[model samples]
Target: MSPFCRKVRLSLAEKRIECELVEVRYWERDPDFLRRNPAGKVPVLKMDGKLMAESSAICEWIEETCPEPALMPATPDARVEVRRLVQWFDDKFHSEVTSNLLYERVNKKLMKSGYPESRNIKAGAQKIKFHLDYMSWLLDHRRWLAGNTMTLADFAAAAHLSALDYISDVDWNRSENVRDWYAKIKSRPAFRSILADVVPGFPPPAHYADLDF
Candidate 1:
C-alpha cells in the first residue's frame, strides 16, 4: 500500500474504527475511484454511509468522532505542534525520502510505469539518514514525535517509515532512540495489520514483522 493510504489505515487502527481495506491503484484512475475522490487518491475513507477524501481531513474527522483514546492533544497549542510534525512527515519527508526510495523502487514496477530511476533511489537512501537522525533527536527529549503522548504525528511518521521498512530500506541501527521508539510502536495492536502488508513480487524482509527488531 502507499504511505498516504497507510497513514489513514493507522489512524483507523488506533481509533479502533472498524473498516474494510479496499486496495485501489490510483494511477489507473478508475472511473468509480475518481468518483470517490476527484483527485483519485487511494485512501478515500467511507464510514456511516459517507465518503471522505484527503488523509489529513479524514484523520481529523476520526479524531473528532472517536474522542476516546485520543490521538490529538487536549490543548490547542499542543495540537498545533502535532499538526506541524504531521505535515513535516507527510509533505517534507514524503517528498525527500519516500518518493525517492519507495516510489522509485516499488511503485514503478507495480504500475509498469518504467524502470526505477537510479538517481531518485540514491537520493532517497542518502536523505533517509537525515530524517532518521531527526527522529532520534525528537525521541531523545519527547516520549513521542509530537510530545509525551502518542498522536497523529507519530502515526504519520510511522506510516512512511513502515512502508520503507517493508522494502527493507530503513537502517534500524542508525539510532538507538529511533529504533527503540519504532520497536515500541511496532509492538502495538494498531501496528499489527501494517506488518502483515504484502505486495506481490516484493516480499518483505524477515525483520519487517519482527518485534525484536
Candidate 2:
C-alpha cells in the first residue's frame, strides 16, 4: 500500500469530498498513466478534467479549494509547522523507515522485485524506535503532532503508520502516548475506508481495523 495515496484519501474523506478511487500500476508505466503523470507516481488526482501529480501538491489544492473542515491552520506559523511535520514524515521517515520496511517486505513481493533484505528490515525496525520516541515526545507537549488541533500533519504521520500497521510492523506498545494518539485518529469516520481496505495477498491483523486498538 502506498502511504502517499492513503494520506490523500484521508484528506478527502476529512473534507467530506466525494471522489472516485482509481488503482494504477505506476511501476508498469502504462502510456495513459504516464500521460497523466510523467513521473509515474501513484496518488495522482484527476479533478475538474485536470491531472494532478504529487501527493502534497494535490492535497494543498484540495485544502485551498475546500476550506471547510480545514486540515491546515489559519495562521502562517501554525501552517508552517503542519507543513514541516508533513515533510518530515514524507521525506525523512519515509527514506529511513517506510522504504526500508514496507517497500522491502511488501512492495518487493507485489512487484516481483526480490526478496526482502534482512539488513534493511533490521535497520527499519531499529529506526522506528527512535521515531516512535520522537512522536511520544511531541505528544507530550501538544494535543496533536503539529499543534493542539489535528491538521494535515496528523494525516501525514498516520498515513505511514497505518500502512505499516497493516503489515504489523509498528510496535504500538513502544509509547503509550503515540498508541493513544493513533487510537484516537484511527477511530474517526474518515478512517473507516482505510480500516476496511484489504490487499490481495495480505490480510491485515484483527487489530488493524479495531477502533479500540
Candidate 3:
C-alpha cells in the first residue's frame, strides 16, 4: 500500500467527505490511469469534475474546500510547522525508510519488479530507530507531532507508520511516547478503514488492528 494514498484517504475520512476507493496499477502505465495522473504516481483524487494529483495538494484542497474540523492550524507559523513535518515524512522519511523497507519488501513483489534487497531492508530497519527516537523526543515536548493540536502532520506521519505497521516493520516498544501517540491516532474512527485493509499474500499481524495495541 502507498502511504501517499493512505494520507489522502485519512484526510478525506477526517473531513467527513464521502469518496469511492479505486485501485490503480500505475506502474503498468494504463492509458486510463495515466490520464488521471501523468506523473505515474499514486494519490490521484478525482472530485468536483476535476482530476487532482499529489497527496499534499489534495489534502490542502480538501482543507480549503471543507474548512471544518481544521487539519492545519490558524496561525501562519503553526501552519508552516505542519507543512514542514508533512514534507519531512513524505519526502525524507519516505526515501530513507518507506522506499527501502515497504517498497523493497512488499511493493516489488506486488509489482513483480524483483526480489527484496537485503541491504535496503537493513538500512531501513536501522533508520527507523532514529526516526522513532526523534518522534519520541518530539512527543516529549508537544502533545502532537508539530504542536499541541492534532493536525495533518500527525496524519502524514501516521500514514507512513501505519503502512509500515501493517507489515510489522514498526517496533512499538521502542518508545512509550511514540507508542502511546500511535495508539491514540490508530484508534480513531478515521483509521478504521486503514486498519481493515488487507493486502493479498501479505497478511497483517494480529496487533495490526488491535486498538489496544
Candidate 4:
C-alpha cells in the first residue's frame, strides 16, 4: 500500500527468500486484512505459520532468520548508525517527501480518494530536493549511507527513492554521487521486481526500467 511495503519487499528479495506478492487495497478496511494487521496494513507477511506486520519489524525478522548477505553492520555502533538512518528515511523522509509526492500523485488515484492537491504536490516536489541534497551530502563522505557496506538503511532509502523515481520525481542529475549510488542499487537483483512494477493510470518513464539510466 505504501513505501513501507516496498521496504519489506526489498528485504525479502535481498535475502533471496521466495515469497508471494499479495496485492492488498488495505485502505478499504477489509475485515480479513484487519485480522492480519489490526491496523489494516498491506505489508503483512505470513510465512512459516506466522503473521508479521510493520515493515521495520518484518525486516528485522528477515535479517535474523536469513543472515546470509547480512544487511547490518558487525560492530554495535555501526549497527546503531544503520538503524538510525533507517528511521531517518522511513519516518522523516516518508513524512517530508514520500507522503507529499507519492501519496499525492499515485496513492490517491489508487485509493479513489480524490484529486491530488496541487499544494501538496508542490510541497512534495520542493521537499524532495532537500532530501536528495542530504543523500548527496552523505554519499560524498561514504560509500553507503551508514558506512562502507550497504545495509538495511540503503534498502530503506531505496524503497522510497525508487518509488519516487517510478513517478519521474527524482532529479538524478542533481548530484553525480547520488546518481551513481542509485545506479548501483537499481541494478541489484533485489531491485528487479520493483523496477517492473506498474500502477494503473500511471505509467513510468522509460528510464525507470533502464538499467543503464
Per-model TM values vs. the true structure: 0.98, 0.98, 0.99, 0.98
Runs of candidate 4 with Cα error greater than 4 angstroms are none
Tens-digit lDDT track of model 3 for 1-213: 799999999989988888899988889999888888889999899898999999999999999999888999999999999999999999999999999999999999999999999999999999999999999999999999999999999999999999999999999999999999999999889999899999999999999999998
Q: Write the per-residue lDDT of candidate 4 for residues 1-213, one digit (tens) a residue.
A: 378888888888988997898889899999989998998876899999999999999999999989888999899999999999999999999998899889988888888999889998898899889988998999989999999999999999999999999899899999999999999999999999899898878889999999888
Each model's lDDT comes to 0.91, 0.94, 0.94, 0.90
As a whole number from 0 to 100, the lDDT of residue 170 in candidate 1 is 97
What value of lDDT does candidate 2 attain over all alpha carbons? 0.94
1-213, model 1: which lDDT tens digit per residue?
688788888889987877789888889998998999999877899898999998999999999998878999999999999999999999999999999999999999998999999999999999999999999999889999889999999999999999999999999999999998899889999999999999999999999999997
lDDT of 2 by residue, 75-192 (tens): 9999999999999999999999999999999999988889999999999999999999999999999999999999999999999999999999999989999999999999998998
| Candidates in order: C-alpha RMSD to true structure | 0.8, 0.7, 0.6, 0.9
Better of 1 and 2 by lDDT: 2
State, as a TM-score between 0 and 1, how close model 3 is to the true structure: 0.99
Overlapping backbone residue pairs in candidate 2 total: 0
User: Which whole-number lDDT from 0 to 100 does residue 181 have in model 1?
Assistant: 89
